[model samples]
Target chain A: MTGRVPEGLRELLAQAAGEGHAPWRTLLKAGDWALLLMAALLVAASYPLLWRGGVADRAIVKRDGQLVTELALNTPRKYEVVGAIGTTVIEVQPGRARVLSDPGPRQYCVQQGWLTRANAVAICAPNHVTLQLSGRSGQNGAYDTLNY
Target chain B: MAPMTPSTIELPVTADDYRIARYAAAAIALTVAETALPSPLPGIKPGLANIIVLVVLARYGWRDAAWVSLLRVVAGSLVIGQFLAPGFFLALAGALCSLAVLALAQYLPPRFFGPVSASVLAAFAHIGGQIVLARLWLVPHDGVFYLLPLFATAALVFGAINGLVAARLLDLPAVAPAEAAA
Candidate 1:
């Protein structure tokens, strides 16, 4: 037996049942509206966190996992660091740094493009050298470091 | 014909048992199949098996749905040879969180709350649980949170699709027992 359902709701349900349509599509209940709003809000709130970008002021270079050099990013210059495998050329431009050349066969380090953000890093595994950017204003406003 | 006696009779299986078994098997199959596909990112999958769980939850209630989901995770992991592994634990965590969310979401008025909303909430909860567990046990680093945005986006997209699929399936008339037997 049908309970004391509203006429409008009963008719909508009947139509949905007859046509094999999802009833929620036709008439959204208050709960569904609330959930939809919440989902939208969540997506909007996370956009800034994911896409935050800032300029870096310091560039740190490491060789064989040891700190070898640290440079101020304010000056534009190209420098080279010799590692066990070969030499790695680093290019610094204002607030960004990148690998101009690397001895690795694949040149993956050169392919890393640039490191302008505070936590950005580039590595030449074959030459055993790494370049990372950091600065007081470079932080993404998130966690300090990532494990995985 | 000889008259049948109580001693010669066999107990008939309940309809609920049959339905549960069918849905659980489907879920398990989906889970195993999903593992074979290559994923672009770690700990991310379409989670298509969740559609079955949602349908069961809508039709049979949360307890039966939970049973189906638990069976799927256990049997599916065993079939894929990932039982007791880190991957298995992550999957289990996601499933438990999703089920818990579904259970709570069911309290909303039926008119406004349906498979889509439930699926979305469940998906987010699933990801949240996995990330928390990963931080505590797997990665143990703050960096894991960096992947949250990617995981959250995946959940939103997949959750909406799965919810729609579940909604379509739920709209169908119940299968006749005679047809099911065939």
Candidate 2:
């Protein structure tokens, strides 16, 4: 449809083309400043929903996306998980956990250093192992050995 | 000799077509170049090409801007060897969302809503659309939401920057209405 433009499309095109060439400032205009503020506020509001703070009370380990074991972080302990490639060693100290060693070549999980905060995770994808730390409010508390 | 019919039908090309092609080419160039820059995450990007879209929106109109933005996504992906791949769809999703937002944002009072405001709004919508698609298909986990703050921050920073660039481009005395494609 080279020349046959729909009425609605024509109107939209005209409306866009007809827009004024307004002047620009750093902040641009009143609505722009307001939008910036709103965007900041929106991002700020998402912090509570997306970010988890406070010390994690438990360390949950998974292999191949399935739960392997859950250990309390109150007691320092060393745990081993047999994974796709080899065993992954996880160390849990009071309120925190870390990957002591992993068979994965990259050692990304080992480099992660620590998972002290709630919802912290160390994933060794090559070994199909994942270690996640959870606080009292963390979602991982939904099921456990005691509950089962 | 009854009739000498041309093998191909010639469609009349308008000035808008040439202008749009030029704008789309510029946008695609930016997209391809931006890919060379290192990113902190796999998906998060500065979206520098959006500046061209903002300029097209202000100078040409929403229709031309939409054409330019979409053509950039498709052609850019093809140039980068990502056509019809996961990355292509993500780019397309972002472009569509931003265009939808810009369509409505255009109606707002120009006195209050200018290029910067439109840029910021489109940026947010762009990320939002990508996140939704990523969550549904790629990652398939709620953990995707964890990236919201980071992506949102990128959108705000890059969106405003692109908008400011567009504003400056619009203000240049040399920039006039699109001349018929040479």
Candidate 3:
């Protein structure tokens, strides 16, 4: 490999060896630091956009793409939703709603644990049942139910 | 006596080809070795292979560095059995973007731009390219972009480290003697 060193690169290498600390001088500049700081700032800015807000005060239950019922999150209650597959039991608390039980292979809806934010949702796809949260922000219609 | 004609044409191998091959092999070795190490994050790796690319870029030039990097990506993916896989595409995208960034960085005033800055710029470009490709083809979710902060931070730290290593290597007197002898 050493035997094949090109003429141009050989000269460059000699210059590098002669300069000693020259490479270090070129490694980091003020502009590079500025770029690094900008990247950090960009990351900081994304925090709010990526943040998930707190739970909302209302819940909407939909069965087979149609509105089934609306529940006041403050009022704790349980509702039984019947679908083609089987019944799904939905429970609503002061600020959260979740699937207590659902007939599905994986019970993914129950696994979702809870939905307490304006756009949070729990769906029992096997039974075609969905429980979505909506409140003050009126961002209820912001995203499609599919996003859940 | 009839003049003897050469039986076969022998193409001379250029010095550039030998150099690129050596650097590419080193980069590939580093990449394969890195795969064996456990990573806490999906996209984060120490990126040790990047040091070779940085060294080649600083010592040789952008063109040689590009050749070395592209060869490493292709050869590395082949060795790891990621050829034509989503991983291969992602790697290719990252390599291309990083090379472009390195080329652009070369134009900066020499006093303010060196291996460290070039490495950092390339690292960011590499990660950015991979994330964009992943979001477009692999995951297709906004969730992927959320990982940018983690990836960017890793790129900065690793890039700076790799740059330092490259700069130190470039400054070595031993390397010059061998090239000078050639």
Candidate 4:
């Protein structure tokens, strides 16, 4: 209590306590602004690293969460899955997959159209069928360590 | 019945316990209340309780702030009926990560870094930890990281706002004077 207060502590107290005339100036310190700027830059940088539209190598069809088949996207083909309700038709071409037709009432899966990017999914919930596109995960390489 | 001994029967509550309890209660209340507010997305939240944590860190110290923050997550999940559930673990992960960041951030030069800076850094850590956990346990897909920019933006926005609020609260004489003693 008797010793002199450090310059940093004094300034922080004065600014936060509103001893200054300007209200905005009291809101954030120089370090706070610097942190904010750095955070923005970091966020901006993540966009390229994370939002990747990887080309799918295969299409996986599932019924009731169980894998029905893995279709190579290189070969254009059509396959049918008999789900809970009725038959759902899936068509794969080159590097994309689409639901040609489904017994689901809403047709939301069909509306999803062609899913070309990795990890894209189309669900025919009424029929309990789902289609997902997967590619070689660049980060994970050829195998998932967790699988072993 | 015979009168109990004063030392054995009395609760071991101290000044620190009382302080932590007070702050923890406030943070827990805010955590529960935040759930009532409608969110556009599932994971995004204003994280109002973090304001209390930031203020406690700046005024009391990181230890008190850590206590308040961790307690809020545990108690808040219990109140919301999500204890031992996936959501609870997500919250715990986020809180733990943020506390770790605050521990380090507190050591930065005071002239440059303050409560606001610490709050922002903690916020980023919070979201980052959550995403990593979700990727490993819930989604199990690399695609999950795509949400980073969105979550990061939310962290920055809410973190700065909460930090500002904490700063304003610290302006009060009761809170401001503690910095010198601490």
Candidate 5:
């Protein structure tokens, strides 16, 4: 509470401060180098995959914090998500998605977009419709189902 | 430079050596805390140890924090088997975002903000980074609608804890008595 020393906290502080230069400068240099290396590694990893196509991931649908029962769509068609007891219908169109639900206090889901790619999701808190996305590129039946 | 080798005075690390042990310690603590912290919702953790990373940034330097984070992410992920999971990527994005926040917070005199503020900023940046990365790699199409209140909540709680720890780290005596007297 008192911004200054408070004994117990001070003792622990003594523990971390430890001894020497505090390695502040060394840490900066190391972090930048590491991030650069990591970015390079990621891009490098993606490069091999990119020449072929793209990475695919799994997408799922959730309603009211629970997984949704059904969702199916490709590039052109729209996937509809309806909550068990809610009036919300989440529509997923190509490149983008939208929600059609009775307006409530939080209109967050209505302003959200479509779920096309892997790991994409749309949640209408009040309406209780949640759309999740998933896929991994260059696979047999690139489009997968949760049942699978 | 070689490690201090426990020479009667300096600690195990070298004078020029910059790998802040706190970063390593924090990563370990965070990884443990992340795993140990009870969660009703799976795969959602605030990464409490990031406070250590934030403190390292303020007390030592960004380079140290960055190195610590890189190692922590890679090491922590490997330990948890999340090295390449979508969630792992989110954590990576968060680490990168925190780095940016640390740089900006550098100007806000230590007395005013300290590690907690920097960490909170990092937590927000980390979440932003995760959202952007997730949208790019995992869920590109539905990126826009992912926004919600939980993101803010996660940032606030995680940031406050990280800051408090960092403040404690900075307040300690710079040198031990015998070593200083020598």
Candidate 6:
């Protein structure tokens, strides 16, 4: 491997390890900033969930590794649940829901209460289980093509 | 097709000329690195060429810096066949936001912050701009919070990497300068 590295090897090395830069786009003009801003603003405006109702995919409920059959989203608007193990109804408040567990006083789940559609979450930290209400990805025109 | 020389006719530069040739070479190299690098998923690149941009910005003015960024976006996008896709838009937004940050960083005296801080600041702004764009013309989701932590983590990691590269590039011998002077 003196001065002349094999011609093919040298060519390969040059192509593979060469430095790079780019060309000019002397034509790109900044015109769509305002429209993009407006669209973002529109989405941000609906954040309070006062006017537009959120539709999360089916909410599943379980207790102690067993499906809680009784508790179900019976109707589009109605909701109810029941459990046999360590389950107790704390209370339901407007714009929120809650549950009380005998696990500990820290009660991170209870403190994380009254979550609306925008802030959909579930915490059964003690049972090592969680249920999350996901917003519609299929219904909205947000997607052009499914990854599948 | 023969590779064209730099745009300026007034200053003719050959392939052997260190200045123009080196920039052209760096552009192609960065473009390949950006497109070929695997990400967590497809259409996801870390904008790694930003290190080169920060270096160019330091050595040259805003104009050349902008050109390098523009070239990377265009040539890189074309090379990867994502020129007109949504991915292109994301890269374009990142480039523009970076240019904005680099231009702003110019005002401050080269004191406490260097390329790393500049790159990090630009990365933060880059994410913000992309999120804003995605929420608007692209997909809509209440899942922004779900992605916030992930993007934030990525920024911290990638931003440091960019800053490090920028610093490294700054130290490398300037083998070539850019043509069209931008």
lDDT of 3 by residue, B58-146 (tens): 77788989998989889999999998988889989999999989989888886765677788889999999999999888864444675
Assess each prediction's global lDDT (C-alpha) against the native.
0.78, 0.79, 0.77, 0.80, 0.56, 0.53
Find the 10 residues in a row with the least total lDDT in model 4 chain A: A139-148
lDDT of 4 by residue, B103-154 (tens): 9998989887767788888999999889999988886544567678899989
Write candidate 5's Cα lDDT for A85-134 as tens digits: 55665554545445655344666656564444444555665666665555
lDDT of 2: 0.79
Q: Which CAPRI category fits model 6? A: incorrect
Report model 3's TM-score to 2 decimal places. Answer: 0.63
What are the per-candidate TM-scores when only chain A is compared?
Answer: 0.59, 0.58, 0.58, 0.59, 0.42, 0.36
Error of 5 at A42 (Å): 33
Model 1, residue pairs in steric clash: A29-B112, A146-B143
Q: Summarize candidate 4's per-residue lDDT along A1-148 as a digit string, tens digits.
A: 5134433234344555565343644767788888799888988887776665664678989999999999988767999999999999999877688999999888999988988777788889999999987876656333221110
Kindly report which residue stretches of model 6 are placed more than 4 angstroms away from their true locations once superposed. Answer: A1-148, B1-25, B41-44, B172-182
Superposition error at B153 for model 5 (Å): 1.1
For residue B46, model 1's alpha carbon misses the true position, in angstroms, by: 1.3
Question: Ten-residue segment with the worst summed lDDT in candidate 6 chain A?
Answer: A23-32
lDDT of 2 by residue, B1-182 (tens): 22388748677779788678777777777788799999998778878778878878887689999999999999999999999999999989999999999999888898887788889999999999999999888865445677788999889888888887666665644333354223
Chain B TM-score, structure 6: 0.78
| Ordering by DockQ | 4, 2, 3, 1, 5, 6
Q: Which candidate achieves the best DockQ against the true structure?
A: 4
For TM-score, the strongest prediction is 4
| I-RMSD for candidate 3 | 8.0
True contacts kept of 1: 0.23
Misplaced by over 4 Å in model 2 are A1-27, A53-148, B1-7, B174-177, B180-182
Lowest-sum lDDT 10-residue window in model 5 chain A: A50-59
